[model samples]
Target: MKRSVLKFGGSSVSDFSKIKDLADYLKSRINKNEQLIVVVSAMGKTTDDLLTSVSHLTANPNDKDLAMLLNTGEQQTISFLSLALNDLDVRTKPLTGYQAGIETRGHHLKSKISSIESDFLENLFESNDLLIVAGFQGFNEVGELTTLGRGGSDTTAVALAAALNCTCEIYTDVTGVFSTDPRIYSNAKRWEMISFEEMMEMSALGAGVLETRSVELANNHNIPIYLGKTLSDEKGTWIVPNDQMLERKAVTGVALDKEMAHVTITYPLDSKTFLTDLFYKLEGAEINIDMISQIQNQEGLQLSFTVKESEEKDLNYLFDVLRESYTNLYVKIETTYCKLSVIGAGMRDMTGVASKIFKTLLTSDIPFYQVTTSEISVSYVVDENYGEKAARLLCEAFDL
Candidate 1:
């Protein structure tokens, strides 16, 4: 018998009616002699609503209290789901991340699961019943409750599957993963499978279907993940391991980062010491850097890099950070930037992939402010004003 983990999103099990539908799916699946492990997120908008209430009440809420409150969303879902399963004559138990021995490192919010006990899970499976585990929230080593950030639920599911070495499938609202977000581009195609590296880049570049961290965990553990719409989930995208080497099209996907900002630092005009010093300064500040571009000229070499806009608010803090670290380099920050990416397996060996991208943008009359490329991806930085137009034109270029 095959063991699989099926995780339902908030929208999939958002309410009483939706919960009933899921319960039915579980009951029927249980009849297949297939060992089932279930993970679910909080009901629709419950986490968001709870956070809104918190923001209104306190500027700095207690982390422990906040986790406790945030966890109630999934708690309610788990208990309700257990009740519905009981109604269908299936014996089952629902365990929160912590109760299932999912120990983590986070104090309150954004805790990473360190290990899963699996003791209770071993006992619960004797009845050949389904196990429903709450997603997102877990406990630290100190036994304090903590929530994984935005994609907590997905992380929860992936973690459990990794710990148990079970087949994990993520259920969303679409049939499977599309070439691009269908809502954004009507021509976006769907891939039957994609490598872990490509998917991780996509998630980092703002692909909303899956979370970046979850993909990392799944990739590390060599686990397969399937993404499909639960509403009409006939088929979804299955993420599988691949070492296949084939020449891919000029571009497999186009990714955009709207909330992007760039920062440039100049050290003494002539020292190799300056570049090294600036990177160390930024690292000490804990500001994640992306697409670091460097240029060497008679005047000091110019070092440019990108960071998300969400981190832009703390830009000035880095100035103090740089001063404390290097005490010698001059720094400047720029926020009016956007990043566009073209990813494919064949980008490394392909002759004119970069040329095609440039021509596509040139024909659209959009000029790239900066361009960065890796073995499997090419990224271009442009003015934020044309970010949307650039993404649309790029998507339409390949009929994606």
Candidate 2:
């Protein structure tokens, strides 16, 4: 039997009315004979609210306990959504991550899906018209519940689609993928279709519409993903195979990452040991470093890199550990910075793309701290205050 994986974000099923609307929409779309899997996130800020409630109990909670607490939000959503469907006489079965066969590994608060035993899910499909699964939470080998990190519901949906060998549709608040975040650049253009390679780049570089790991999964499985607004019949963006992307643009879109922090470490000159040790420590800590710029000075070697602001705590601890070695070391942290990037597959053969980005920043008087380039994208770290302006300027410069 053919099946489709449909995922709804938090905002899509925030309230009873929204859940009812979703049930009605599903009723209209599902063929009586076909199988359907629906993955849903916690309604609205329920997850955040849960976290806040936990925070009131303890500032430093155990990772395992935190996961146990956070998983409840998604469970509530799945159960409520399933009840709504059942009310419509749509034979629906709601399952938590573990019951649905989602197996995950790694730390509790942030875990990677190891594999999914789909036999249980297949069995459920035989008896139900719809299988509703909780997103973002799974169980480990030891049977402890774990929740995937932020935007994990997307990962859950895509992984299920891949496992089930079906097409995936992600329903969010946005109508479709756009040239840039419309909230930042009001004139951002919507895309009808985007290549997986381009979409992967955009997602990795801070396009919040889809999770990076989810895109990687979709690309690896050659699964097509459709993203659109809920409660609407409008056509949305399709993330398809590269061969399906016949019309390529020089610049596909602009992405802004506002949650970036800039860190600089200056150590004694002529000390390659310090450089090696610091890098190894960062690697050991599993910190994702981006846009690194190193300068060798007469007095010292200065290293600057960009990382997610959430890692400030880890970075600070590492800095403290290193301070013991380099007594005179200097460290600086800038939290009010963001990365603005332009990505497209056409950039592989395009010229003057970097120049255009630079020209836009210069004309707008937006001073950039650092710049990095890849085959398909150019990213610049700039003041957060200039983030939107820089995106708009680059959007116009590249004609996105």
Candidate 3:
């Protein structure tokens, strides 16, 4: 018997018609001797609408309560999809994260999967040809309903595939991974195959197709991932190990992250503990800081970093507390900047990749505020208004 996991994103299961279409497609794929596991996200805009409703009730709803309410979105999808499949004479069983024995740990709003009880799922396959499971949520050790963060449905799908020891197929709006976001660069080219390491870097730098955590999990287990448009016959991109890649390019793709907040702080040079105290508080809050730079100038010790704009509120409160100790502290938070990055596995043995990026942007008269690099990637922070132009220029320069 053949077993595999399939995941459909929100855009793919947005309505009753799409659900019906997906059910028909799945029915055709299931063989008499095969068992399939399907994972699904909430209907289009359902999770966003739920959050908006909670905002109307209170600015700060209890974390546990919020998780409890948000989980209903995916549960709705699993049930609806199950009903559709059942109508077509398919033996389907719908299971929520908790029901499927997915245990999670950590915060209520952004929990991580600890382990999955695959034996329970295998037993269900004995009596059913398909199991529809909810994505993005699982129960914590304390037995409270918890949600994974944004793009978490991808993580759930990959994790389940890892546990089941099978390949994963992810269906979304995009046909496959591209050289860059097609919406930003109309000439972006779709990739036939990508290395797991390259995919992880692109995801973390801001490619929305797959979650970074999901790519990391798949890479760790050597699981192959397929990404393609839903209900389409087009050949999609396959993510595999570096050794499995057919060709390695110095720059495989360009990624643009617009949801960034640039923070620049100037503290008195005499305050030796300023940097230590500030970072300590940020670490405690679990706020990720990136592209950090520190300089000692006549004015003071200047520090600059980038963080997700969604954490602006928490950052405001953190700086307020720091103000008490350092009365001369000066802080500026700018949300009008974006990060553009280029990533590839072949860059490990390549040089001038960074030079090409810098020259491309400079010659185009684009202004960048900060820069950072890894062995496989180089990122730059530029004005949000010029982000698209910068990405396009770099894509052209690298023939991406």
TM-score of every candidate:
0.86, 0.95, 0.96
lDDT of 2 by residue, 89-113 (tens): 8989998999988999877877889
lDDT tens per residue, model 3, 185-283: 899999999999999999989888999999999999999999999999899999998789877899999999999899999887665688889989998
Ranking by TM-score: 3, 2, 1
> lDDT of candidate 3 vs native?
0.91
Candidate achieving the largest TM-score: 3
Q: Per-residue error at 341 for model 1, in Å?
A: 1.2
| Total colliding residue pairs, candidate 3 | 0
lDDT of each: 0.79, 0.89, 0.91
lDDT of 1 by residue, 1-89 (tens): 77788888989988899998889888888898778889999999999999899989986688799998998999899999999999999
lDDT of 1 at 44: 92
Q: Looking at model 1, report the run of 10 residues with the lowest lDDT sum.
A: 242-251
Cα lDDT, model 1, residue 272: 65
